[model samples]
Target: MTAPSAIEVQDLVKTYAVRGRPPVRALDGVSFDAPSGAVLGLLGPNGAGKSTTLKILTTLTRPDAGSARVAGVDVVARPAEVRRRIGYVAQRPVTDPMDTGRENLVLAGRLQGLGARAARARADELLERFDLGAAADRLVRTYSGGMARKLDVAVGLAHRPEVLFLDEPTTGLDPHARAEMWAEIERMTHEERMTVVLTTHYLEEADRLAAHLVIVDHGRVVAGGAPSDLKDALRGDTVVVEVADDGATARAGEVASRVTGLREVTTDGRTVRARTSASSAVVLPALLAALDAADVGVASATLARPSLDDVYLSITGRAFEAGAAAETEEVAA
Candidate 1:
């Protein structure tokens, strides 16, 4: 039998009213289920309602309509219970600079009603687990950006919650720190057996971390499934053949089109990429033959399986990098 859903959201609608402008519909009839012990990626570009959806699920804010639940407790009706079972890490860093890392975690646990001893013990354990043991006694103000972010997450997990929500967890993290955070998150997912709902604009993060991927755009789920399944749905392998000059792109596509199993060919500048059923059998040989026949110079050729990035672009007509840029713009504006 299938396991019961750890989190369920149905027809959730949330809108915010600006003082001078019209209300923005953040979540428009959004729906999805996250089963126990699974990582569900809530993916989308900026203004796509990823944060709004998370707010509703964590019971941090009320939805204008519809309903949601965490661990079977109604998000709106039993918000306290929902909080008790979930660990929430917001998109922005939320750490008290006045307190030491250990003190912050201890305070969080005590606020959750744990005994002083238990809270201290939990703080110590998490500090070590998150690689902050040496600096546990240091004030949060003394910590690096990544270290402070780690403390924020540790504080949220003080109660050993069964569900965890990480909103853009690696955002603003340096490359090395981001890798560390990824490892830390992976370890927590396994050790705690927690159901994680991760909202991220990073396509590779979702592809690597989430067991189930859900793509949301403008507050609607446009795609949902396992990463491999979604990639497979796009069909076959992709062969990219780069030509020497700008005029060679169209010529390369024309050549690739005549290839036996190639389904589609697209040319951007001097690069020609094609989706084909048989990269080995029809795509490679036929493309090379055609290029040779046309006297076109082949600089390099690469065959790769489709990635979640390709799938995202195929569905949304926008690249993940573009989405990331838009998110940054929204933040800046």
Candidate 2:
């Protein structure tokens, strides 16, 4: 049997109006389906409608045109039901600074309609599981960034929601904390059997954690598939060969074109990057033979299987890390 969709969005649109200005469209004709018990990585740069999409799914905001359903509940017609079934962790901080970690989680549960006793019980369990038992009594303002973020996640899970929305969950975390959060997310998804929809500007994070991905750009999806499949779509492997100068670069391109089963040869004065089906059997050996025959000295050569980052660059014309940088600017402004 096929798995059911945890979240389904069709022709979603969100437009914001400002004084003395044309309305700004956040999400325009967006559509996708996420399977139950799967992690769908909704990736895009800043202002790419990622946050807008999450807001619609979590019932924080309503779409202007299209319909969205989370856990089989229509977002517009039954937003309350959708909210109850889905847990939302925003990209920004939402916990109260005056409240302790445990107190914050308990309050969130109560707000979600859990009884006092049940809320406290769930809070304790999550605090212990998230490795926050020792600091559960600490005030949120006094807690470290990582601890506070963990508490926010704990609050989202307090209601035992069926689908979770984590918007840039590790955005402000340090390396160690980020890794810990990733592991925690993986563990919780497995243990609770909940579907997760996460948005992130970090390609490495998406590559490592997501089982499937949908790459969005400027309010539209450009690519969607498993990471391996997307990477394989770039063709066999990438070979980066460094040569002497512009002349060597041109010669290398000519050589790569002559080499069988190779295409998309891009040169940058001293570096030549190309895609080839037979990296081991055909491309590499042919390039080496050509270089030798042309008397063009090769500084170095390296072959790497295509990565998710490569796919992003291929579709967007910019590096993934560059998009992260742009997102920083957007957030700051």
Candidate 3:
């Protein structure tokens, strides 16, 4: 028999009141299930309600409508119990700069209800497992960004919670550090068999790490499925034409749509983006010719395998980068 879900959210809605402005709806009927012992990634832009969803699941805030459960406990009615069963690693560091790495972990363990002696043992075990044993005695202020991030995650796991919540787990780390964290996260899930729900802005990261992915936009789930399944849904290739003149985008899109085999054609700024089931070998030439026929100047064009970015664009009509950069204040508000 299938095991019960680690998290279940149905029609969750949350609204935030911004002084001097209308109240912003941060969540609107958001719903998804994260199976036990798997990673569920909340993928979206800065203001797309990803963080709001995490807050509700972690019991940090109550939803205005709908319902949620974490580890079989109703979040609204049993928030304290939900908190006890989950570990939260926020986007910002939670470790104290004045304290050593080991100290931070021990304190977290103690607050989670471990005895003093057990807390130290758990801290030592985590320090070794994360390869931070060498630096466990050093003040957190002296550690690099990556080292500190690992410590933060370690602290969250100090209690061996059944489910872990990670908000933007690798937001500020360097490329090398980000990769390392990805591998570590993967290892922990496989070995610990714990449920992890992480919200992130990186398209590739979501594709690489999540067993199940949820795409949020404007406070709702636009699409969700296994990462590979979602990418495969848009069969064939993504065609991108970089129009030389910004003014020609409209003409490029209109003319490109008339071309055979092209679908989901849309324009963003000076670029015309679309998808086609035909192989690039047959479609690229026709696409360019169509643009040329419309007198649309093409700086360059590319055809690539459908990716998470393409999926997001196909569903949302906006590039991942544009969405992330467009508006960044909703979560903060």
Which candidate ranks first by TM-score, i.e. highest?
3
lDDT of each: 0.84, 0.83, 0.90
The regions of model 1 sitting more than 4 angstroms off are 19-22, 241-260, 264-273, 285-300, 326-333
- Global local distance difference test of model 3: 0.90
Every model's TM-score:
0.86, 0.85, 0.94
Which residue runs does candidate 3 get wrong by more than 4 Å?
245-248, 292-297, 331-333
lDDT of 1 by residue, 1-333 (tens): 887899888999887776787877777899889988878998888887788888888887898899998999999999999988998998777778998999999999999899999999999999998999999999899999899888988987999999999988888889999999888777766776788899887788898889888888887888889998999899878788899877778877888888788866767667776777764665687788889999999999988889887787778766666765665222111
Q: How many backbone clashes does candidate 1 have?
A: 0
Best by lDDT: 3
lDDT of 3 by residue, 111-160 (tens): 99999999999999999988899999999999999999999999889999
Write the residue-wise lDDT of candidate 2 on 87-189 in tens digits: 8888888899998988998999899999999999999999998999998898899999998898888888999989989988998899999999999878766
Question: lDDT-based ranking, best first?
Answer: 3, 1, 2
Clashing pairs in 1: none
Worst 10 residues of 2 by lDDT: 324-333
Cand. 3 TM to true fold: 0.94
